[model samples]
Target chain A: MHISLKPELLFNLGSFPVTNSILTSWIGTLLLIVIAIVVGGNFKRIPAGIQHVFEMVYEMFEGMATEVMGAAGKKFVPLLATLFLFIITSNWLGVLPGVGSLGIYETHAAAPAKDTHAAPAKDAQAKPAAKDAHAAPAAKDAHAAPAKDSHAKDDHGPVFVPLFRGANADLNTTFALAIIVMVIIHVMGIKSAGLSHHLAHFKNPLEIVSEFSKILSFGFRLFGNVFAGEVLLTAMASIFVIITGNNLLAYGALGGFIVFPFLMLEFFVGFIQAFVFAMLTLSFLSLFYKTENSEPHH
Target chain B: MLESLGINPVLMLAQAISFGLLYYVLNRFLFSQIRGALEERSAAVSKTLADKTEIEHRLQAFEQEQKAAQKKVAEEVQKMMLDAKDAAASTKAELVAKAKDAADAEFATAQKRIEQEKVAAEAEVSKHAKTLAQSIVQQLLSEKASDPQWQQEQIKASLESLKQSKS
Candidate 1:
C-alpha cells in the first residue's frame, strides 16, 4: 500500500470513522492542559525546581505574546501561550520513533506527514531500455487492479487510527487553524471598531473587490506556508527511501539525521507561523476596532 | 479526500468553538489563579524589601541619636569634674587665709604683752634706782649739807659768769 500524510488514523474507532487531524488536535489540546495543570498545580512563594523552569518558560511566552500582540494581548496571553506550547509539542512529538515511524496495525506510514513519491530514479538511466520492458506490465497491472477492486471490501485500506501525528501536516488542521485565526481577527476588529466601522473595511464602495482580494491573500499566505512546509518535509524523507532502499521510518530517521538543519528551520518556522497567526489576527482587529484614543499607529 | 475520516468543515468549526469556550472558562478559573498568585508573590517580596529599608533607616537614626547622647554625657562628666576641682581650690584658699589671720593676731598679741612687761619691769627698776639714789644723796647730805646748797648756788653763779664771759 502507498504511504501518505494520513490524518485519517486519528478519527477512527475500530471500524467507525473519526478524523485523525481532529484527534491529533485533541491530543495536542489535552497535552496542553496537562502541562498547564502540572506546572500550575503547586503554588508557592518561592518556586522550586520544575516550577522554576516552567515559570521561566511561561514568562518567556508571556513576553513574546505581549510583544507581538501588544498591550491588548495581555488578556490573551494564556490562550496564545497554550496554543504555541501545544502546536510545538505536537510537531516535535511526531519526531519520536514510535509515534512518527510506527504505523497503525503494523505498516510503514508517513509518521508526521503523509509520505510522497518524488525521487528521480538514479539507476533508471543505467538500463532504461531493458528495464522499461519489464516494468511496463507491472505498472499496467497495478493500475488495473485498483479499478477491478474499487467496490471490493478491503480490511487493510486507508483508514483512521488514534495516535500521535503532526497537527499542521494535515490540510484540514491548518485550514481550521487559519479559519479560526481569521475569525478571531474579525471578532477582535468588531470588538475594537464596532460593527459598522469594522464592516466598513469590507464595505468600501470603490474598493470592495480589493478588500476581498486582500482577505483572500491574507488567508492564503498562512495556508500556503504551513501546507508547503508539510509537503517539503514529506518529500525530503521520501527521497531517502529511494536512495537508501529503506522503509518510510528508516528514511525519515536518515533524513532527520541528514536534514536536521532543515528540521531546526521547521521548528523556527512553526513558531513564526503560530506568532504570525496570532499577531495578524490581533493587528487586523486593532486596525478595525481600536478607539481613536488608542495608539494612533494601530 | 479527508471526508472519509469525517474531516467536515462543520465539525472543525464546532470543535474550535467548543475548545475556545473551554479554554476561556478554564482560563478564567485556572489562569486567573496562577496569574494572581504570581502577582501577589512579587508584590509581597517588594513590600518586604520596602519594610526592611524603612526599619533600617529608623535604626540608623536611632543609632545616631544614641551616639550624640553618649557624647553629651561625656561632656557633662568633664564639666562636673572641673566644677569639683574649682570648689576644692576655693575651700582650701579660705582655710589658709583664716589660719594666717589667726597666726598674725597671736603674734601681735604676744608682742604687745612682751612690750607691756618690759615697760612695767622698767618702771619698777627705775623706782628702785631712784630710791637708791635718794638714800645715797641723804648719806652725802649728812656729810656735806652746807656745801651742797653753797656749791649749787656757787656752781650756778659761776656757770652764769662763765656763760657771760663765754658769750
Candidate 2:
C-alpha cells in the first residue's frame, strides 16, 4: 500500500506545479460553479429538482447562521456554505474508486528532491527526542541502504502517482480555507468593533496564541480527518488484497465486504467534518463579534 | 514541515482566490435572488392578509349597515302600516258617522212627511164622513117631515151622543 503525506504533483503550469489535490479542487470548483450557474440562471418561484436541493442547503445553512449570529449571521452564509460544499465535495471525490487508485508510474527521480530533504526535517520536528535517542541509528541505516544501492536505481524507481487526491488531504487547501476564514473573521471584527477595539483583544498573549491555534485547528482538523479516512480506506483495500492472495477476482469480490463499510464511514466522516468546520467558523465569528458585549456586568 | 506537506503559498493563495470567486458568484446569483424572492413573497403575503382583513371588516360593516337599514325599513313599514290603519279607521269612522247622520236626517224627513200625509188623509176622511152624515140626516129629516116626534127624538139622541163623546 502506498500513502504519501503530500499530494502528487500532476504537472506544471508555468512556475506553478499543479498537484493532484489542486486539480481535484479545480474540478470541484468547476462543478460547483456549473451548479450555481444552472440553479441561479433559471430560478423558479417554485423550486424543483436540483433547485430544490440547492434551496434546501441554502435554508439549512441560513438557519444555522441565524442560530449562531442572529440576524447578522445571514451575511456569512455564502462563505460558510461555500466552505461546506467545497470541503465536502473534495472529500467525497477523494474516495471515488479511481481517485486514489488511478495513476501513472513515474520514477522517483521525476519527483522533486526538495521532498526528500524536507522529510527528515519534518520527522525530526515531529519526534525530536525519539529520533535523537532511539531512531537515530535506524534512520542512518535506512539512509545507508539507499546510499549503498546504485543511486540511479534508488532514485529512478517507479512510483505510483495518482492523478487526483482529496483536496482537503492537502494541507495547502485546508490551510488556505482556514486562513481565509480567519482573515474574514478578523476583518469583520475590526469593521464592527473598530480597529482599536479589535486589536485590543491581542493584549492577552493567550488570545494571540488562540488566534493562531484556531487557524491550525481549523486546517489540521479537516486535513487529518480526510487524510485519515483515505488512509483507512487504502489500508482496508490492501488488507483485502493481501487476504485474497493477490487474486484479482477474489480481491474484487472480497474487497466490497471489507471496504464498503469503511467507504460509508468515510462518507459520514466527510459530511460531518464539513459541517463541523462550517459550524466552528460560525461559532468563532459569533464569539469574535460578541466581544463588544464582553464587558463585565457591574 | 509545511514544505514536506506541500503547503505552497501560491497554491494556498490560488485556493483562496478560487473560494473568493465562488463566494462572489454564489452571493450575486443564488443568495441575493433567493433573499429578494423570499422578501417579495413575504411582502405579498402580508399585503394579501391585510387586504383580506380590510375586506372582512368592510363586509362586516356592510352587513351591519344592511341589518340596520333592514331594521329601519321594517320599522318604517310598521309605522306606515299603523298610520294607514289609523287613517283607514278614522276614515271608516267618519264615513260611518256621516252615513248615520244622513240616515237619521232622512228618517226624520220621512217621519215629518208621513205625519203631514197622515194628517191630510185624516182631514179628508173626516170631511167625507161629515158630508155623508149630513146627507143622511137631511134625507131622514125630509122623510120624517111629517114625523115631528121622530125628528125631535133623533135630534135629542144626536145631542146626547155628542155630549157623551165630549165628556
Candidate 3:
C-alpha cells in the first residue's frame, strides 16, 4: 500500500480539483465563515437573535475555561475555544451521509476520512466477527485493484490520483501531534529551568533506568490509544456493511444516523486529547522548575 | 497508505491550513468587535445611572430651597397680621379716650346749671316769707289803736251792731 502526498488539479495548476472531501471541507469552512459574519457583523448595543446565541456560546466557553484553569486559564480561553469549535466542526462534517457522495470527477468516495474499502472500522476487538463476515469480499474481489496501487495500476494513461486524507485518521497525524506536544513541553521546561537543571530530572543515578522506561511508557500509551481508536472505527464500519446485505439498505441509513452520536463522541475525544497535550506540557514545565506541587518526601 | 485508506494526505494538510487561517481572521475582526461593543454599552449604562442620580440630588436641593422660601413667606404674612392687629387696637383705644373726655365735659355743664337753679329758688322763697309777716303785723296794730278811746261809746254802738249782725 502506498500513500501519495502530492495532489493534482483538474486541468491547470491554478484550476480546482473537484473532490468530494475537498468540496465538503470547503463547504463547511464557507458555512462557518458566513455564519460568523452574519452573527458578528452589524452588532447592536442590545443583542438579538443570532448575535444573542453567539454571545451565550461565548460566555459558556469563557465560564468553562475560567472554572477549569482559574486565572491562568483565562489566557488560554481563546486557544481552547477555537480548538473546540474547529474539532467539533470537522468531526460533524463527516457525519453527513452524502458529504462526499457526488459532484466529483473522481471515482465514488463517501466520507472524506473513509479508508481503502470505502468502509469505516469500529472497535478493533470486534475484528474477529467483522473479519468472518467481510472475508467474502476480499476473496471475491481478488481482481479488484488494491487501494494503495490503484492509481499506478490504472492502465488508462498516467492519472495523477490524489491520496491525502483526513489528518486525524492516519497514525502519522496522531504521532506527529504527540511528538510536537512533547517537544513543546520539553522546550518550555528547558526555558523555565536551565538545561542542566531540566536534565537533572532524569540524571539521578539511582533511577536513570526507570526514567528512560517512563519516557517510553508515555509515548507508547499515547500511540496505543490513538491507533486503537482508528482501527476500531475501521472494523466497526466493516461489520456494519456485512450485517447488512450487498444492497445495504437498512444498515446504510442506520449508519448515517449512528454516525451523529459517534461524531459527538469523537468531538469529545478530540477535546480531551488537546487538553491532555496542553496540560501535560504545562505540568512538565512546572516540574522542571521545581514549582509544581511535588509530593512530600515523608 | 492512500491505497489502504483510499484517500490523500496533501489534501488534508491543505484543508487544515485553510481552516486555521479562516478561524484566525474571523476571531480578529468579528468576535473581538462584538466583545468590545458589549463592554462599551455596559459602561454607558452605568454612567447614565450616575448622571441620573446627580440630577435627582439637584432636584431634591431645589425642593428644599422652595420649602424654605415658602416658610419665609408664611412668617412674613404672620408678622404683617400681628402688626395690623396692633395698629387697630391702638386706634380703638384712642377713639374710646376721646369719647370719655367729651362726656365728662357735658356732665360738668349739667352740674353747673343745677347749682344755679338752687340759688335762685332760695332767694324767691325768703322774699315771699318776709311779705307775709309784714301784712299780719299791720292788721293787728290798727285794731288795737281804735278800740280804747272810743271804746265805751263806740263799743256800746258797735256791740249793739255786732249783736244785731251776729243774730
Candidate 4:
C-alpha cells in the first residue's frame, strides 16, 4: 500500500497544480452551494424535506455559535456553519468506498518529482509485487510481462495517485480555513476595539506567539486528525488484504469484519473534528469579543 | 517543508475564495432568510396574541355591559309593572266612586218624579170627587127640595177631607 502525507496531483490547470484535495474541496463547496440555493431559493416559514434538514443543521451551528459568542456571534453564523458543513462534507467524502482507492496509475517518471519521500517511493515499488501475487489467474500471464518490463526499467514503479482526497487531509485547505478565520477574528477585533487597542495585545511576546500558534493549532489539528484517520484506514485495509491473501470472498468478509468498524470510527472522527474546528473558531471569536467588551474604551 | 506537506499558496487561496463564496451564498440565502422568517413569525405571533387578548377583553366587557343592560331593563320593567298596578288600582277606585255617585243621583231624580206624580194623581182624584158630589147634590135637589142643607153638609165634609190629605 502506498500512503503519502500529501494529496496526489490530479492535473495541472494552466500551471496551477490541481491537487485532489482542492478538487474535493471544490466538490464540497459546490454541494453546499447547491443546497444553499435549493433551500434558500424557495424558503417557507414551515420547512419540509431537505429544507428541514438544512434548517436543522443551520440552527444547530447557529445555536452553538450564539451560545459561544453571545448575540454578537449571530452575524458569524454563516461562516461557522459553512466551515462545519464543508469540513464535515469533505471529511466524510474522503471515507467513501472509492475515494482513496480509485485512481490512475502514474509512472514515477511522469509523476511530479517535488514530493518523493523515501518511504512512499519504497511502498510504491513494493506495491507491484503485491499486485502480481494477487492478480487473477486468467490475467496474471497477460499482466506479468508488462509488470516485469516496468520493474526491469527502473528501481521505482508507477505510483497509485487517487483522484480524490479529503480536503482537510491537505494542510493547504485547513490552513486556508485557519488563516481566513483568524483574519476575520482580527478584523472584527479591530473593528470592535480600535486598531491601536487591538494591536496593543501583540505587545506581549507570548501573546504574539499565541496568535501565530493559534493558526498552526487550527490548521494542524484538522489536518492531523483527518490525515491520521486516512492513514489508519489505509493501514487497516492493507492488513485485511494481507490476512485474506487476496481471496475475494475472504477479503470481502475480513474487510467487513475489520475495516467496517474503522470506517465507522472514521465517520465519527470526521464529525468530531469538524465540530472541534468550528467550536474552537467560535470560542476564539467569543474570547476576542469578550475582551473587547470588558476593556475600557478610550 | 510546506510543499512536502502539500501546502500550496495557490490552492490555499483558491480554497479561501471557495469558502468566501460559500459564506456569501449561505449568508444571502440561508442565515439572513431564516433569521428574517423567524423574526417575522415571532412578531406575527406576538401581534396575534395581543389582538386576541384585546378581543377577549372587549368581549368580556361587552358581555358585562350586556348583562348590566339586561338587569337595568328588568328593573325598569319591574318598576313599570308596579306603577301600572298602582295606577290601575287608583283608577278602579275612582271609577267605583263615580258609579256610586251616579247611582245616588239617579235614585234622587226617580224619587222626586214619584213625589210629583203622587201629587198630580191626588189632585185629579179630588177633582173627580168634587164633580161627582156636585152632580149628586143637583140630582138630590131636584128629587127633594127639602134636603138641600144635608147635601151641602156632605159636600163640605168631602172638601175638608181632600184638604187634609193634600196638606
The candidates' DockQ values read: 0.10, 0.52, 0.10, 0.54
The lDDT for every candidate, in the order shown, is 0.55, 0.75, 0.48, 0.74
Please report how far candidate 1 places residue A143 from its true position, in Å.
12
Off by over 4 Å in 2: A110-156, A243-247, A290-298, B62-167
Please state the error at residue A79 of candidate 1 in Å.
Answer: 2.4
Tens-place lDDT per residue, model 4, A1-298, is 4356777777787888888889888888898888888888899889888777766767887788766666667777777878888889999988875566555555656445433231223223332222212222212322333433211235344545566678899999999999999999889888887788788878889998998999999999999999988777665655645454453534434444566688889999999998888888888777656443443222
Better of 2 and 3 by lDDT: 2
Candidate achieving higher DockQ, 1 or 2: 2
Q: Is candidate 1 or candidate 3 better by DockQ?
A: 3
Q: Give the DockQ (C-alpha) for candidate 1.
A: 0.10
Estimated TM-score for each candidate = 0.57, 0.68, 0.44, 0.66
Q: Give the C-alpha miss distance for residue B114 in model 3, angstroms.
A: 44
On TM-score, the candidate that comes out on top is 2
Those runs of model 1 whose alpha carbons end farther than 4 Å from true positions after fitting are: A1-17, A37-54, A61-73, A94-165, A178-229, A243-256, A259-261, A275-298, B1-8, B25-29, B78-167
Instruction: Sort the predicted structures by lDDT, highest score first.
Output: 2, 4, 1, 3
Rank order by DockQ, top first?
4, 2, 3, 1
Docking class for candidate 3:
incorrect
Model 4 per-residue lDDT at A39: 85
Best by lDDT: 2
Candidate 4 matches the true fold with a TM-score of: 0.66
In model 2, what are the clashing residue pairs, if there are any?
none
